[model samples]
Target: MGAKERYILLLIIDSLIVTFSVFIGYYILAPFFLQYTMPVLITTSIILLISHHVFAYVFNLYHRAWEYASVRELMSIAQAVTASIITTYILNILLFQTTFTRLMIITWMMHLILIGGSRLSWRVARHHLIGKQSSDQEKLRTLIVGAGKGGSILIKQMLDTPAMNMLPVVAVDDDSTKQRMELAGGVRVEGKREDIEKLIKKYDIRKVVIAIPSLSKTELNEIYELSNHESVEVMIMPNIDDVMSGKVEVNALKKVEVEDLLGREPVKLDTAGIEEQVRDRTILVTGAGGSIGSEIVRQITKFQPREIVLLGHGENSIYTILEEMTGRNNNIEYIPIIADVQDRQRMFEVFETYKPNIVYHAAAHKHVPLMEYNPKEAVKNNIIGTKNTAEAACEYKTEKFVLISTDKAVNPPNVMGASKRVAEMVVQGLNQNCKETTLVAVRFGNVLGSRGSVIPKFRKQIEAGGPITVTDERMTRYFMTIPEASRLVIQAGAIAEGGEVFVLDMGEPVKIVNLARNMIKLSGYKEDEIGIKFSGVRPGEKLFEELLSEDEIHPNQVYTKIYRGKTVSYPIIEIEKTIKQLENNNNIKELLLDFVNRKEYTKN
Candidate 1:
C-alpha cells in the first residue's frame, strides 16, 4: 500500500481500538451501566482516542514497517498506549472529579494487547503468504555450512525473498554447542562439516553455501572437499565488507574458486612503510598491461601516488589499465607510455622525462615452454629488457628500482628461468655501481589466473567438455594470487636495502594432478566426467619449482611471508658481457644457464 493509505488505515484501526478499550473497561468495572453517566463514558472514549493518536505520532508507530515488526515495534506500541491511558486518567480527575484508576489500568492492558497484536499479525501473515507462494515455485534445496550470524542472515534473506528460488533446508556447523540448533527461517544445524556429504544426500541438497566469513583457507578447503559433489553446486558467501556495506545482499553467494583452496593465508603488507615510500611519489611500472604488472599498478594507486607512469610494449593492455585507474581516481595522474623496455634510447628518454621516484620492472618473457622454443626472444626481453630499464632508472637516479623476478630464477632449468636470473643479476650488479638508487629483486612462484597459467587453461578445457591436460602427473609448482604477488612486490620495494634478493614464501608446492582434480570438482564435475590426460613433461619444465636456491636460503623472515636472500654479487662487466654474447649465440639457452649456475660467483 502507499504510505498515505497505510497511515490512514492504521489511524482508523487505532481509533476504533481506543474507543472500544475505554467502553470495555467501564462495562467490566461497573456491573450496572447506570453507575456512570452516558456523557461521562462518551467523554472518556473521546479523550482516549485523541490521546492515543498523539502518543502514536510521538512514538512514530504509524511510520514503522509493521509487516516486519518485532520486539522493538511491540515496545513502541506499548509506550504509545500507556501514555494515552495516563493522559485519560488525569482528564477524568479534572472533569468527573473522580479518577477511574481501576478502569484506566484495565484499559491500558487491553490497549497493549490489541495494538501490539495487530502489528505482529501483519508480519506473521506476510511470512505465511510468502511461504505458501514459495511452495508453488521450483527452488534449489540448499545446505548452509555455517550456523553463525552470516548463515542466519542468509537463511532469513532466502526465506523472505522467494524470488531468489533457494530453499535453505539445513545448516552444518563444526561447533558442537550449535548441533541440532535452529537458526533463522527455522533451518536446523543438522550436523558438523564432516557430515556434509551425508546431510546433502539426506536433505536432497542441490546447492551448498559456506557462510563463514572468518574461515581460514585451510578450513575452507576442508569444508569444500567434503561438499564437493558432482550434482551439488557449491558457493561461498561474499566478503563481510561487501555484505555489511550493502554492496550486495547477504544471500548473494559466489561460486567457490580454485584460489580459495590454496590453503595459504594472504601475506600482510607493511602498509605504513609502503605508504611512506610510495605516497605522493612518481611511480613507474613497466609491462603494466600484463596480469601481474597491471595488478601492481592498481595496488600502487591505493597509496595515492603523485603520478603513475604505465610503461608497456602493448598499447591495448596499457590503455585498459589506464582507463581503469583513471575511472577510479582522478586526483592521481596516470600516464600511459607505449614503449618497449628493450628500446634502450626510448627507455632512457622516458625515464629522464618522468624521473620516477620508484620503478617496478614487470615486463618479462615468462612462459617456460614458449621461452624454450625461442630462447633469443627470452634473452632480448627478460634479460636485456630488464637491463635497459634498470640502467635508465640508475641514470635518472630513481629512489628505488624493484625487479619482478620469479622462482624459476632459483637454480633455473628453462630459458625463461635463466633469463629472469640474468635480469636479477643485472639489478644486483647495478645496485653496487649506482649508490643513488636502491635496486632489489623480488622472486615468487607461478601467479594463478595470469595469462597462460594452469588454472585458466584448466577452466577452458573443462568448458570444452572433458580431457583436462596436465603437463606431468608428478609435476609440482608453488602458486600465489596475482594481487598477493603484486602486493609483495610493493612491500619488497619498501624493505629494499640495495641488492637483496627478496624471496616470497609461496607456502608449499601444489601437485599439478591434484590441482586439476580440484578444479574439476569446483566446476561441478566428477573426475570421470572431466577425464585427465597426461601430456608428459614438456621441454624446460621441471618436476618441481623452487622459491630460493640452497645458497640463498634465509631461515628467518625479514617481514611476514617475506625473506631476504643472501644473494651472490656478480661483476657488472661479466653480466654485461653475457648479455652481449647471447644476442648472436646459437646455444643461448646453454650459455644462459651456465652463467647463472657458476659456483665461483657465490660470495664466500
Candidate 2:
C-alpha cells in the first residue's frame, strides 16, 4: 500500500486495539474495587483510549516502516502510552480526584498489554498462521545462515510470507555477541556455521539459505564445499543493495554454482602487460572454436586489438561462436578464418598476410585413445603442425607465441600426451635461437568439459537412462574447469620467459569411478538405481596422469597455484633429423612410439 493508505489503516487498527483494551481492563477490575459509577469508569477509559490513539498517529507510530524498524519502534510505543497516562494523571488529580486507584493500574496494564500485543500479535499471526502456507507439509525445513541484519530480515520474510515451500527451522551466526538473541516472530539464533554438521543431522535440515551476501569468494567456496558434502542444497540471498534498489527481491535467491566454489581471485590482468603487446596489433588463435581458444578470443578482444583472427577448421563451430561474439559485443573487428592448423600452406599464408603480433596455438590432436589408433595423425597435427606454426611465426617475426600444452605431456604414457610433449619441446627448441619470436608453452591438466570431455558424456549417459561409464575403478586424473584452464593459459602466456613451460597445480587428483558416482548423485539418482559400468582402459591410457616428470621439477613455484618445469632441451640436430623424417614419411609408427611413448601403437 502507499504511505497514506498504510497510515490510515494502521491508525484505525491501533485505535480499535486501545478501545477494546480499556473495556477488557474495566470489565474484570472495575466491579470489584472501584466505588465510582461503572458508567463513569468506562467513559473515562474511552477518553484515555482516544487520546493515546491520536498520540500514536501524531508520532507516526502506526506508519513505521517494518523493514527499517528495530528497537526504535518499541521506544515509540512507550512514548505513546506514557503520553496518554500523563493526561490520565492530570485529569484524575485535577478533575476526578481519583488518585492511584486500582482501576488506574488496571488501565495502565491494559494500555501496555494491548498496545504491545497488537503489534506483536500481528507479527506472530502473520508469520506462523496467516502468512504461512495452508498446507504446512509443503515447507522445506530451511536453515538461515547469519543471525545478523540480512538473516533476521530473511527469517521475518520467510515467516511472514514464505515462497517455494520453505520453513525457517533455525538461524546460525558466528558472532558470540548475538548467540542468545531472538529475531522477530520467535526465530531464535541457533549456533554458528561450525554447528552445521550437528544441526543438519539433528534437525534433518535439507536446505541452507546463506543470508551473508558480502562474504568473499573464498569463504563462499568454503561454505559451498561444506554444503555439497552432505548433499544439502544451498541458496544465497542477493546483496542488501540489490534488495534496497528493488533490482532483486528478497525472494530472488541464487543457487551455488561451480564457479562460486572453484574460482580464485578473478585474475587481475596486467593491463600494461597486455596493452603494451596487444594494442593496435594483430592476434591469431588456432582451434578458435574450442573452449580455451574461444575464451582467449573473448579475452583478447577486450584489449581492443587492431584485428582478431579466429582460425579453426570447423566452419559451423566458428560460425556459432562468431554469432555469439557479435551478439554480445559489436565494436570489435573479427575475421573468422575456416582453415585447419595442420595445413601448412594455408596457415603460412594467413600468418604472413596478417603478421599477427600474438599467436595462441591451441590446436592439437588431443583424444588419447583416438590418437593411439591414428598415431601418424597425432604426429602430423601435434608435432608437425606445431612445427609449421612456430616456424611461420618465426618467419613472420611474431612478438609472442603461446602454445597450449597438456598435463598428460609429462612422462606421457599415451600418443596424444607424447605428441603434446613433443610440441612443447619444439617451442622450447625454437626459442633457443629465434630472436624475432618468443615461443612459450603453458601446460595444464584435463578441463572439465572441453570438446569430447567426460562431463558431457556422463550427462548424455544420465539423460539416456543408462549406466555411467568409467575406464577403471583406480583410474585418476587432475581436473580444472574450462574457463579456469583458459584464464590460466592467458595468464601463463603473459608471464612466460621464452621457452618456459608453465603448469597449474590442479589440487588433488580425482578418481574416475568416484567422479562418476558423484555425477550420478548430483543428478539426483541413487547409486543402485543408476548403475556404474566398467569399460576397461582404452589404448595408451594410464590409471593416473602426471604434471611433471621426476627430472623436470621446479622446487620454487612461480604463480601461487602454478609452477614452471625445467626445460628438457633436445639436441638441435636430432630434432632436425626427426622433423625431416616426419615431413617425408606418411607412416610414423616407430618415431611416434619413441617420442609419444605410445605403448599401444602396434599395427592392427
Local distance difference test scores for all models: 0.89, 0.76
Which candidate tops TM-score? 1
TM-score quality measure for candidate 2:
0.74
Write one digit per residue (lDDT tens) for candidate 1, span 1-604: 8999999998888888889887888889877544678798899999999998899999999999888776778988988888898998999899989868888898999888888888888889999988887788889999999988788878878887877789999999889999989888789998998899999989899999988878888988888878777788889888767897999878777888998788477777788889999889899999999999999998988888899999999999999999999998559999999999889999999998999999999998889999999999999899899999999999999999999999998888889999999999999899889989999999999888999899999999999997999988889989998988899889988988899999988988899999999888888888999899998898899898888788888899988889998966889999989888999799998899899988878562
The TM-scores, one per candidate, come to 0.87, 0.74
Off by over 4 Å in 2: 1-135, 148-153, 160-162, 213-231, 237-269, 328-330, 571-573, 579-589, 596-604
Error at 120, model 1, angstroms: 2.5
Clashing pairs in 2: none
Best by lDDT: 1
How close to the true structure is residue 352 of candidate 1, measured as C-alpha lDDT?
89
lDDT of 2 by residue, 394-448 (tens): 9899988999999888777677887888888788889877898889898888887
